[model samples]
Target: MNAIPVDDDSLTWGVPSRRVAAFFIDSFLIMIVTLGFAFVFAFIHLMSFGLLRGPAHLVLLVGLIYLAGWMASPAMATPGQMAVGLSVRRADDLGRATLVQAIAFTGLLYLTLVAGVIWLGVALVTTRRRAIHDMLSGLVIVRAGALEPRPW
Candidate 1:
């Protein structure tokens, strides 16, 4: 009697075992840096008699946050990621993403967020356990100093 072979697809990727704290830490750290840009924009608006203080300010803040998270993710990863032992990397390439690449990811992430369900799809997928924004940006959040490969 011949036996059929089986293939396990779960071994292809890994999801970091850390709890949500790392995600929050990375987000908060990026936001703090982005706030600096917000303040500058705010101050400039203030000098102009509050012309840009409301909706315009909010739009600028969101954009600044995206830019900060994308561009400085690697820099912040050295420390902020070190704090939670998590780091961000490109998914398919599995290497340090360039600043421009990161920025592009941020822009695409905004586009992906138009529908809330897309984010859910990202988190639910079997590939790397990332959010839709991550998928759109070609990025992954992984353990920083981990040595062993995950069995997925």
Candidate 2:
């Protein structure tokens, strides 16, 4: 993978706004996935005399896991983040984030959602535009393609 320009000021420019957009996009995608699963599960639920309702709820968990995997993939961003030209990186070295970090970020992100989205407002005031989960996970969201690979 190419090295990211961690030192460039432009790396974080407009991140807060882009992140907001990405949030909506990702949410919609997740909703679609959930609905699709729900539809199939509902049919099975009927066939199985309502015994499938419990497993149907697992769709949410699967969606969360998928989101984390996407974030930790080589692309370094979720589908929504990629759509908005944003990427996640390690806060300490701007290196690609590990799967562990991505899972942590995803879990905390849902926690923030449950606690009220006001937590996201932190990005507006933070120097790096990081949300609470981003900070806790030691990751930063930046404008993708803002930094070119350093010829090392």
Give the range where candidate 1 is weakest over 10 consecutive residues by summed lDDT.
3-12
Residue clash pairs of candidate 2: none
After best superposition, candidate 1 residue 104: deviation in angstroms?
2.7
**TM-scores for the candidates:** 0.54, 0.88
RMSD of 2: 2.6
Best by lDDT: 2
Model 2 poorest 10 in a row by lDDT: 1-10
Q: Candidate 2 lDDT, tens digit per residue, 83-133?
A: 989989999888899999999999999999899999889988887778899
- Candidate 1 lDDT for residue 85: 61
lDDT (Cα, tens digit) per residue for candidate 1, span 1-152: 32211122232234444424544565676677667767787787888897766644464456545544544555434344456566666676456766766676666655665655445455656555777666667766665444234454
Output the number of the TM-score-best candidate: 2
